[model samples]
Target: MSTFGTLYRVTTYGESHCASVGAIIDGCPPGLELSAADIQTQLSRRRPGQSNLTTPRDEKDLVQLQSGVEQGVTLGTPIGLLVRNEDQRPKDYTETDLYPRPSHADYTYLEKYGVKASSGGGRSSARETIGRVAAGAIAETYLKRAYGIEIVAFVSSVGKIHLPSSIAPPSAVPVNGADDNDDVEDSLSPEFRKLLATISRAEVDKYTTRCPHPETSERMTKRIIRAKDAQDSIGGTVTCVIRNVPAGLGEPVFDKFEAKLGHAMLSIPATKAFEIGSGFRGTEVPGSKHNDAFVRKADGRLGTATNWSGGVQGGITNGEDIYFRVGFKSPATISQAQETAQYDGTPGSLAARGRHDPCVVPRAVPIVEAMAALVVMDELLIQNARKTAAALLPAITTLPPTMVLPKGKQ
Candidate 1:
């Protein structure tokens, strides 16, 4: 279950309090320029202690490029990456060894395996996602270099504070393709795509809340502080947009595009719900309004006049910007004490232990983007294979540089 993807697979290992956490990336293309710096950029973003809104524990998370490359070029072998766990406070979780915390994996992990790690929720900790983010950085590099695909995510809401729809990124397509259009269209404009390309993680980090809209970001940060003072946690949603994805990337039947995206998303810690394109709000709209209009693009490929389908239709990419949202529940561990019983039915009260984020959505931003990268990279590889197979015809089967015909037959 730890292994993910078909061709671009990644297997993660280690736990929150373990000596080190790392990943094995098995399917990266050969000759991609990769380095520890590329992987460290994301690990730093996901590492704790960057802000008051997240866990304050400092994990250097300095990644080591163990193998699979030489002189900065990939060898197309299994790439192994490692990040040592610094400042691990396993002692913070000592109390939970006997009494499993409420709403945590402490109880179920014990039931399923008859034994548990007894620290930092073992493999259930958000710290484990470091491996995923690291692996995803590799996938993202390949996807961008190969397909010009770009993925961006930010905090859309924290508690009840939300970035107003007025300042939200452009959604519907621009009919006139103008930058200052007052009227909204059903599809994205060339102007909007231009704007999306300029966004970067450095720009996102300028705001502590990671919401690109400056005014709303300040508000979200204040709200997180309030929750932290109250010793409680709040839940919120993240909206991600994947732009410049080409057509015909998804697989049909069982391994559809959105299906794989959802599976990867929910696999992350604390994710409760997943939605794509117009998602739930689209449910209220009639089919006439919800359906995307097909218009031939200037590039000559048929494009959508609207993205109500969220860049996907019939379980495949249609050369549009695919957008989606993921909802995360409040972290179950809180500083407030709750009355509960021990595993042996003994009466007790438990206040959660360990360094925990007051709101995970802020830190979850990079995790979401990483998971999205993994899914897209996997699907793109499959699509490439399919395209190559379809091009293999009887007339072309005997071509040079591959199959060679006998001297007389040639």
Candidate 2:
């Protein structure tokens, strides 16, 4: 249950306040360059104590590569990684012995497993994502070198504050209420589309909120600081874009591209919602307005004039840039006292202690990117294997034009 993917499998381990947390990445293609530093970039971004808005846990989160590499290149074996938990304070969580934190996994984990970690949120902690992020970085590196894929994620909203690109679809008219003359823009603004195409991780990292928009990032900072001051927490959404992905990468039916992506994103701690492309906004627009008309690219490949499908059609990729958003709930572990029940169902008040982010979206950006990379990387390998196997068969030149794929249909 700790692992993900089929061919490109990843198994994460350890818990919060444990000796270490990391992952073993299996099925990475041989000969790719890899190192602890390659994984550290994203880990550092996910680490705590980055600013006043984040927890003061003060973990270096330094990753140690344990196996699957010689010199500087991977050997196509399972890559082992570890990050020591240097700043654990188990005593701070002693109160949990009598009470389970509200809105947290404590009660549910115990109910399912019959026992729970003695300190912090245990496996539910964001610290568990360190392995995920590290594994994603490796996947990302391979994806970049092999296919020029680019994955970038940034904070789109913090509490009530949302970037202009992520605002509600005021332009959307109700499907039944709209006439032919009714104005509708079910897709993101052209400017936002441009930003999604061009925004870089460096620009996202420039702000503490991990939001590339300057004015909105400043307001998000203030909002998170307010929660930190109140000893409470806030929630928000992260938007990620994957560019330069080839077509025919996703599996249909069960393992659809967006479905796998949703599985990956929702697996992260504190995540509450996941939406791809137009998401809930598409419901308001009629099919007439929502359909993405096919267009011929300059290079003669088929392309979508409007990517309302978020680069996917029929649950498979359509060669356009894929994008999605993930929503994270407010952290359950807060310093403020809350009226809750004890382990025995007795009513009591609990004021939780220990370092926790007031808003987790900023740090969640890298995790989102990592998961996205894993999904794409895994799907890519699957698709490649299918193609390689299919290539061994004789070409069916007698098939009808409609049944057979046209030459160079990408």
Q: Return the TM-score for candidate 1, rounded to 2 decimals.
A: 0.89
Question: Cα deviation in Å at residue 393, candidate 2?
Answer: 0.9
lDDT agreement with native, every candidate = 0.82, 0.89
Tens digits of per-residue lDDT for model 2, 206-320? 9999988889999999999999999999999898899999998888899999999999999999999998888887766778888899989999988988878889889899899
Question: Cα RMSD for candidate 2?
Answer: 2.3
Tell me the spans in candidate 2 whose CA falls farther than 4 Å from its real position.
165-182, 406-410
Q: Could you give candidate 1's per-residue lDDT for residues 212-331 as a string of tens digits?
A: 878888888888888889888888888788888988778887788998889989999999989887676554455765678799889887897777787888899888888787888888
**Which one is best on TM-score?**
2
Each model's TM-score?
0.89, 0.96
RMSD of each: 6.5, 2.3
Clashes (candidate 2) = 0
Clashing pairs in 2: none
| Residue pairs with clashing backbones, model 1 | 172-187, 173-186, 173-187, 173-188, 186-305, 186-306, 187-305, 277-310
